[model samples]
Each structure stands twice: as structure tokens, then as C-alpha cells.
Target: MATHLTRRGSIYYLRRRIPLHLTEQYNGKREITRSLGTKSRPEAERLARAISVELDREWQAASEAAAMTAEGKGKPKIDPRYYDLAGAYELAELEEQHAAEVDELHADADRLEKLLAIVERRREQASAGNASKAATISAEARKPRSGAKGNSVSLESVIELWRRDRQPTAKTVDAVTRAVREAGDPDIHAVSRQVVIAMRDKWIEAGNSVATVNKKIGFIRLLLGIAKSRGMIDSNPAEGAELPPPKRAVELRKPYDPEQAEAVMAATAAMQATDPAMYWLPRLARWTGARLNELHQLRVEDVQERDGHPGLLLTNEGEHADGVAMALKNDGSRRWVPLAGPVLGFAMWAKGRTGPLFPAKANKYGNVSDSFSKRYGKLLRNVVKITDKRVTFHSWRHGFADMCRHAGVSAEVRMALMGHAEGGGAAAAYGAGDGLPPAMLIDGIKRINGDSA
Candidate 1:
């Protein structure tokens, strides 16, 4: 099959000789050799075939360029593919050396003896056909070599330290770890500007939006910055690497048209008795323009008398009545959203509830609002049949904002009513804690609700 698969010790590796013309581009490396990290011949052959196909394309391109240059009597432009592949290989080789150096710096004679014992045990296990146990020990060997006081560390080791140091959310840790690992998992000290650029290009080529790609790159930057701050590396390779600015107009969420809004309300109203989330969430969002999580995380206690009128308090002040910690998007998100119009009766629905108003929707992370967004999306698609991608559950918030703007509500009152940051100097700061007067809030709410109270 021309897969160029070879056995090195007991592991399978792919070893492909560089074409004669491309050897100079590779800095005189005669062949590209990489471990498949597997012993299964079938799996190794599959991987080797894929790698061979990729290399063949680059080699063919280089040969064609050389032919064209010779005919024209000019120098051929170097293909960036050569440098990207070579850079990955260079970093892979450096990671071994970096790990060894860090180990020497930190390992005492006793520590070295213990490590050698572990290695002996692993090799014995491997020879006895207990490959899984050997593999487990192999991973253990990689981890403790992390030199907390030395100048070099592996990417995985730094990621572990970063997680401990940052105490990032599980979601954040998974995302950052995935991004770094996918970017060739370069040594902490070996990640360069070219490595970051190559990673970005790969994501762009895989059809990620510019925003998504940039977010992933931001994770890499933050991760490498952690290594740099601890003196494990001198600089973050991803510091200045980013894609060109996206040229398309930013797609804003579209507010529902009159028919669409009515359709959603009708669907929700039918199921109000059986599914409270379906019924009340849309109404609340439409009237208050509160963010999805803000409404989802509301406690029954939040639905009470505020300034002698019923309202929903969307603040991260304390825990849920059940003790799940509250989280707000920002301080601006902590304010009173008075009940009015369609949502005026929300307090009645929440009357007997003690903890989360939507307890059934609480995710395992104690974020009581996570599942509602997806459920509402299904309702929009399967039940209401509003299939416009931009017309999501958040569209109710957009519709509420549009309603306020169309009703000639002033910007400051609108900002305060919607829990938006009021940016208007010290004057804006005066009564922020007090929120808009209940009367003013009710007035604006009624105006947007199309009922002049």
C-alpha cells in the first residue's frame, strides 16, 4: 500500500523519505519519522496512509514549482507547507529533550532511582502483554517530570498547572486543553509564532467562523501565557498570531415578526400548565428583554414585592433557595425586572416554589438555566416551526428591545429597565442601586407591553 509503516522497538512508526528536491526545504532531513503511538499494524497502516497522502501533495507541489522555476530561470518560492510540517517535527523532538532536561534539574538521586524502578515495572508489564498498564505508567512518567522550578515544561504539564493556578471552570479547562492539544501539542518552550499561525490556518480551513477560530486562539494564548508567567517559557508563541479580520457584516439576532411572536406565544400558552418553562420563559423574555440564563436562574424568592410592586430580581446576590450559587453575566446584569403585561402573573406561578422556579431545568453544574435554551430551540423548530436560524429563544429579548425603541422609550430608562450598563457619567451612577423607580419601570414595561397603564 506504500504506507511506509515501520516497527521501532515494539511501537509502530511512519517513516517517509523526503523527495530529493524537497530535502533542502526540510533542512537536509532525509526522511520524516513519527510514532503512530500504536502497536496495531492495521491502525498504524491507516494512519501512515493518511500521512503519506498529505506529504505526497506537498512534495508534488514542490516538484512542480521547481520544474516551473527551472524553465523560467528563476528561484522558486518556498512552500509554507514544508515549514509547518518541519516545525511540528522540530517541536516534537524538542519536547523529549525539554522533558529530560527538566527531569535532571528537579530529580534527586533517590527520585531518579524511584523513576527507574517505575520504568522497570512498566517494561515488565509490557513484556507480559499488559500493554494498557504499561501505557498508564508511561503517562505517569510524563507528568511528574514537570519542573515546577525549572525553565522548561511539557504542554500538558503546564496545562495541569494552569488549571490549578487559574481554577477555571470545567468548560474553560476542556476548551483550553483541546485547543492546545490540537495545535500539535508543541513543547511549552517550542511553541512559536509559526505554530500558532499554522493552528489558526487549520481551523479556518476546517470551516470555523472567524469568531470561533479567534476564541480558540485566545485559549491558546491564555494557556501559553500561564507557562510564560511561571518562567517555564520566555514568551507566548500565540501572542501576536490571529487571523485577518472577518469581512462580512456581523449577523445580529432578528426579532420575531408579529406572526412569529404570536405563534410562539400561542404554542407556549397551550403548554403552560404542563411545562412552565415553555410558557413563562418566552413571555418574561419578551417583556423584560432579560438574557436567557438570567430568566432561567430566577428563584421563586426573586419573584416578590419590589418597591410595592411584583417583579423578578435577576441578580447574583446569593445562592438559590436550594443553595446553588447564583451567577450573573456581569454586574450590569444584576437589577430589577419588574413584572408587567404578559409576565405580570409570573409571581402567581412562582408563589409556592421555594428554590429554583425552573428546578427541572437545572444542569448538573448547579447552573439552573442551562437546558432551557436547547429545549426552547427544539420547540421553535419542531412545534412552532419557526426555522429561521437567527430567530432563537434570545429573539424574545431582541423583540422586547425593539418594542421599547419603537415606543419612544428614552435610552437611559431602557438601559436601566433591561439591566444594561448605564454609561452616562456619575449621573447614571446615582440611583443604579435603587434601580429605576417602580412606577417608571412599570410605565416603560407597560409601554413596551402595548398597554398604557
Candidate 2:
């Protein structure tokens, strides 16, 4: 066998011993082992067999090249008319290098056939005394010719364009830039499949989650795609280089129960009494089902009347007052959530505030949502003492939806109130109406409060 399949815990790897002669040339390297990127033994074996064949071809070509390079070996006979013995020797060495390159790249058979035909023609010239033709070919091979412009796509340029255009948070963009830099920031087109796979493996070895590593791969593809579209590179090397699915399943956040909901409200009220305006965030998120940062980053003017009804508006419009430019998570996130019940007091309090309603938390992460998420999770775990790991701040959104469903709120009203995407036939219902009135949204909010209203 050219190579063997080895199991590392559950996953399989392809392992091949390096040839003895080339081992020294590789600085004492002994084996080449690669993860087959599969957990199924059968699939791993199938992938292994194909890769093993490629490795054998590579090693055979290397061995032949090494033998030809041996001192006083494979000497060519001189025939001055057709070709000089010196030129034949040089051509032999070049052919050896070309063969090894073809094996390494797994180039098409037709390309290898073309290289062989060139070698045969050179040999015929040496035998039949075609010195001028042989010399011309050799000289041309040595001359420098302009190739494609892929190499000009610089690492710095891709990074700049991605940061400027994509507008990811500082934490996200900086992490992506750091990963690319750690990968040595190769030219965009030069990031071959092998290089990208190795980079992903490095992340896995460093204990990064599969999801996080996948996002990194996405960033690499996105950055390189930008360069390719502008003709800077031949293609995006990172395209289609996705890793296998993770072993673990994704866990969804669970909803807060009624007692737990009451505890949260009590916490908010305590904070509100001493809370001033700071305590209003929970109430606003509860009443409107708006995101934590959506409420946290609100300006005084965000309080507006839509369709002649008073409500709090959630918009992707950035920089409430020439502040940091913030965008919504997606198009579905931008909508007007009606404000009512306890949230009315909070809106009245912010009627004329010039700056952000919660400036302190908003400025911390350049991502107030992220900062609030951590603090809220800690509040639930440490203070509120809710031990359910599945529940988090995101669960409040689910709780609102649950309340709307239990209260028999029309699907259209529920989707409109929570900014959820209306799907299928239900979308027409929303369009058929002028808009959801604040009174209807208040009824739903009151249902969430268990008729305390």
C-alpha cells in the first residue's frame, strides 16, 4: 500500500511515509499525514485512496528527479550538429522539474502529454542534428515573459476593501485581519486549497469552534471575491473551501417561564426605582420585543408616531446624533414596534433627550448589543439565579412570540409587532392592511404580562 488510513479517536487520517532519499531533502521529514475531514470510516477510506494515488505519483516523480540529478549519472552523448550535449543535459533537468510540478498540481493528462511531446522533439533534434531549433527553444525558455496579474492583488488592499465595504464590527474585522496576517498574508490568488485547509486546521488545533472557523473561511472567500471581480486575481482561491459539518448540533435559546418572567420584571423595577431611565431597557424590550441594543442605543427622536399611533421605531438608520454608525442585523430587523403599557413612561421620559438614551452601554463595545448580552446573561445567571442554560436574553424575543401565539394574536399582528419576516400567504395579510394599530400591539404586550394590565 502507498498509504495507510489511521484513526485518531473517531476521525480518520491519511498517512504516508516519505521516500528515504527525499526525506533528507525535506529536512528529515518522515511522514505526510492529513485529516480526511470525515468521521465515517468508509467515506474517509474512499477519499484516502484517491489522495494516496496522488501522493504516490508525487513521490515517484521526486525519486526520478533525484536519480537524474545524481553526480555522473544519466550522461547524454554529444552530437554537435543537432544539439550540444550541454543543452541536452539542461533540458533533461528542466523536464524532470516539470514532471514533478505536474504531479504536485495534479494537472490534466493532456498537459503532461504536451510536456512529454516537447521532450521527445528535443531528443529527436539531438539525434538528427537540429542545433538551431534546440538552441532557440532553450533561449526562449530562459527569457522572461509577462504572465497574469493575479500576483498584484495585495493582502493590504483586500483587507482595506473588506473593512470599508462590509462594515463588520471592530472586533469581527480585526479578528479576520489577524487570521489572514497569521497565515502570512499571501497574494489573494496564491491562497491555494492546501494553504486554506491548513489554515482551518490551525484554527481547529487552537481550540476555535467549527462555527468560528467557518466564519473565518467565509471572510477569506468574501475578501478574495472582491479582488477577482475587479480583474486583480484569476479567481477567488477561497471559494467552495468549506469545512465539514461539526459533530455537535446547534442549541437554541429557550423561553423564560412566567415565574422567571416575573423575577426579571422585579429586577427591572428595582433597577428602575433606583434605575432612573437605566431600568427601562428590559421593559422596552419586553413590551416591543425589540432587541436589547435596539432599545439601548435609541435617541430621543426614535420615539415617533407611526400611522397616527404612538410607538418606538426600530430602524437601521445609523448615528442617532452624529454618533457611531450602527446598522441593523438584517432587513427583517428594521420595523416600527408599537410602545404601550409600562413602556409609555419610558418613552415620555426620553421625549426630549438630545443624545442616546443609554449612551454609557452603547459606547462600550462599538457593539452595545454584545455588551448588553453579556451583562444580561450574568444578571440572569448570577442575580436572577435562573439555572436553565438554554435561556438567555434572546429568549425574551421568543417569550414575546409565545405570548402572542397563546393570546391568539393574528399572525400578521405578531410578525409586525416583533419585526419577524412574514412568510407565504401571511405576507399579503400585512400588505392588505394599512398597518398594525398601537392598541392591538398593546393587547399582545398585555398578554405577555398575564393580564396584569
Per-model tally of clashing residue pairs: 0, 4
Instruction: Tell me model 1's lDDT, rounded to 2 decimals.
Output: 0.69
lDDT of each: 0.69, 0.64
Error of 1 at 275 (Å): 1.4
**Candidate 2 backbone clash number:** 4
Q: Single out the weakest 10-residue window by summed lDDT for candidate 1.
A: 424-433
lDDT of 1 by residue, 244-330 (tens): 666774555789999999998888787777988878888888888888878877877788676677888777665553335566654
Worst lDDT 10-window in candidate 2: 425-434
Query: If scored against the real structure, what TM-score would every candidate get?
Result: 0.57, 0.54
lDDT by residue for model 2 (1-453), tens: 222666554345776666655788778987787776443345556888899789889989987887678635766553665446446644655565456445534643776588569756655655332344333333432333234363345454687776555545546666777666545466564556566676666667657888788888887787778887777766666787877676675555777888998898887666754644437776676667777767776877878775555677776554533334444554455666656565667766777567777765345334556666677788888888998888887777787777788877787778777776567332432321236666666566556556635
**With candidate 2 superimposed using the best TM-score fit, by how many Å does residue 162's alpha carbon deviate from the native?**
3.1
Off by over 4 Å in 1: 1-150, 153-168, 184-189, 223-240, 244-252, 321-323, 410-412, 420-440, 450-453
